[model samples]
Target: MIPVNEPLLNGNESKYLLECIETGWISSEGPFITRFEREFAATVGRKHAIAVANGSMALDAGMMALGLEEGAEVIMPSFTIISCAAAIVRAGCVPVAVDSDALTWNIDPTKIEAAITPKTRAIMVVHIYGLPCDMTAINEIARRHDLKIIEDAAEMHGQTYNGQPCGSFGDVSIFSFYPNKHITTGEGGMIVTDSDALADRSRSLRNLCFLPARRFVHEELGWNMRMTNMQAALGCAQLERLPEFVERKRAMGKLYTELLQDLPGIQLPLPETSYARNIYWVYGIVLKDEIDFDAAEAMKRLAAKGIGCRPFFWPMHEQPVLQKMGFFKDADLPIAAKLARRGFYIPSGMALREDQIREVAGMVAEVIR
Candidate 1:
């Protein structure tokens, strides 16, 4: 069966990994970690970048760096991965979620103002599936309310919004280097910021909050979420090829759109918007209401045809874990719910070839027909 996702590691990845092994700097304290952080920060136009064990930990560190008061509310999209909401809840802040836009499949900026309350301390805008949220509008709202912005740019490595990079807009932004992501370091994440204090605090938080002068003593609680030298080595290699990866993804998206543009009973992802072009991190398709089956059945049929597919994230409002905590109780977000049930993405990995894409598209057409 064709895989749903495959990373393209045809760069300096092996050379760097070998160098790390040869130098015996395979741990988190190696020079590669610092080098990777510096380069990544420059790449994103941020003053600082802190590498962590994984993307989830990056969110956790970023939320902690905010130093929000207990029960402070953070507004975010309900259509995002659990990590976004989990970080807020773990940081002792209440996560208030809004619905997603039907067109962009991103957080609806129009709904953000209504979700904001007196206790709201931050607005975490997740750049979902390589499509940026309306940051121009979101930033305006944040400025009016004095709320901090946390950008989850995990799916938008090289994506931009109105000429500005996604990570540059947030007070503390994050990216993941998971295998399925545009860049891969096996498992790694980064938190970038312009504020010196936030950067220092994020570093401390990820490293057990040990005082700079004293190694053993600690002033506050923190976690060991450091990214290893080996991981950073891989990241450096991946970073070098990010631009090319993004272009390849865009081309793949165009190819898919071209192949399936006239297919019935499906809503394809938009290729471009006025704010920014969709990077097509994954080529998602939302089955129309006229379709008889949900994404699960569609995925099953695709798999049978040797075409790999993955479903979109389940909305946070429907999660039993959050429901038990009384979050989003009685809240009805129709767009997120419908998309969750009907949306699934075909093979759009960077490593995917033209033939593979055509095969996948043909199989999807057959299955849907």
Candidate 2:
């Protein structure tokens, strides 16, 4: 059966890993790791990029760098991976979620003002499915309220908004190097920021907050979330091919839109025109309300046809952990709930074969035709 994603590994990846092994500094502090961070910073146009264990930890570090007190609220979209909201909570901050926009499947900036309170400290925006949010409005709201902007740009790497990178918009931003991301380092993450103090703090926090040279002093609490040199080796190779990967994903997105446009009960996700270029990480095709299938049933049907399909993420508000923690309450996320029922992720992997994409489109059209 066709899988939702397949990380394509080129020959250079193995070569890099072998080189790291030959050097015998394969832990975390090697040439590859240093070069990876520097290269990533240059790629994102940020002053510093701190390599960490995973995306969640990068987010937690960013939150910690904010120096906000416990219970400070950080507003984020309800419709996202649990990690986005969970990181805020893990950082001793409140994860206040708002509704998502139906068209772009991004945080509805229009709904943000009401959620703001005296306790609000930050606004985290996810560039969902590589489609950018209304940064103009989100930035304005943050400016008015003096809230920090933390970009959970894990799904967006090379995409730009009117010539500005996604990670550049926020005070601090993060990217995941999971196998499914634009570039894979197996399991890795990086945090980018312009502030040297925040970068140093984040680097310290990820490395047990160890002092510059004194290794034995217990200063502020920290975690060992440093990325391994092996991951960095792979990251270096992947970074070199990111632009091509993004272009391939965008091409597939265009193909899917054109191939399935005439099919009934199929609706394409609206692209954000404000973004100078869209990087389609997970291309979503929203089935019409009249369709007989919810996302689950749709998946089962697709699987039966020897094809792979995934349901859209469940909104954070609908999660069981939120209810158990009493952190989530009734919120009007009608669009999120609706999309969660109808939306499912199509195979948009950069390495996905064109024939595979075409076959998947054919299977979809067969069902909805």
Candidate 3:
């Protein structure tokens, strides 16, 4: 069966990993960590980048660095991964969620203002499926309310918004180097920021808040969320080939669009918009309301045909864990709920070839028909 996702590691991945092993710098304290952080920060146009164990930890660190008070509300999209909300809740802040835009599949900026209350301290803008959130409008709102912005650029590595990089817009931003992301380090994450204090605090937070002068002593609580040197080595290699990877993704997106443009009973992912181009992190399609089946049935059929597909994120408001915690007591987001039930993405991995894409498209057409 064709895999839903496959990472391309043909660059200096092996060479870097070999170097790390040969130099005996496989741990988190190796030079590759510093080198990767420096290069990644420069690439993202950030003053500082703190490497972490994983993307979830990056969010946790970002929330900590913001110094949000307990019970402070952070406005974010309900359509995002659980990590976004988990970080806010773990940081002792309340995550106030808004629904996603039907077009861009990103957080609806118009709904943000309504979600904001006196207790709201930050706006977490998660660039969904490689499409950037409406940063201009969101930034304007943030400026008006004096709220901080935390950008989750995990799905968008080389994507831009109105000519500005996604990571550059937030007070603090994060990227994941999970295997499925544009870049891969097996498991790694980064926190990028322009604020010196945030950067320092983030570093401290990732390293157990151990004071530099005192080896084992700590002033506050923190975690051992450091990225290994081997992981950083892989990340450095991946970073070098980012431009190539981005172009490949665009080509794949275009191919999918062309192949499935006229397919019936489904809404395809959007192309370029005025604000940002759709990088098609994965080529998702939402079954029309008239369709007889939801994404689960569609995915089952696809898998039966030896084609791989994954469903969209279930809205946070609908999650059992969150619901059991007495959260979202009065929340209702129809758009996110509909998309969750109907949306699923076909194979759009970097390693996917044109023939495989055509095959997947053909299979999808057959199933839908």
- Top candidate when judged by lDDT against the true structure: 1
Give all TM-scores, in the order shown. Answer: 0.99, 0.97, 0.99
Question: What lDDT score is found at residue 169 in candidate 1?
Answer: 90
**Residue 41 in candidate 3 has what lDDT?**
93
Residue 107 of model 1 has an lDDT of 95
Model 2, span 1-369: residue lDDT tens: 888988889748999999988989789899899999999999989999999999989988998888889999999999999899888988888899899988888999999999999999999999898788889999999999999999988988888877787788889999999998999898999999999999989999999988887887977789999999999999999999988888888888888888887788877866447555557898888888778877788878889998788889899888998878887777668888888889998787767998998999998887765
Candidate order by decreasing lDDT: 1, 3, 2
Q: Which residue pairs clash within candidate 1? A: none
Model 1 alpha-carbon drift over 4 Å, by segment:
none
Candidate 3 segments exceeding 4 Å error: none
lDDT of 1: 0.94
lDDT tens digits by residue: candidate 1, 1-369: 899999999899999999999999999989889999999999889999999999999999999999999999999999999999999999999989899999899999999999989999999999989789999899999999999999999988999998888899999999999999999899999999999999999999999999989998987899999999999999999999989998999999999999999999999999999989989999999999999999999999999989888999999999999989989888899999999999999998889999999999999999999
For model 3, the run of ten residues with the poorest summed lDDT: 272-281
The TM-score that candidate 1 achieves is 0.99
Give the lowest summed-lDDT range of ten residues in model 2: 269-278
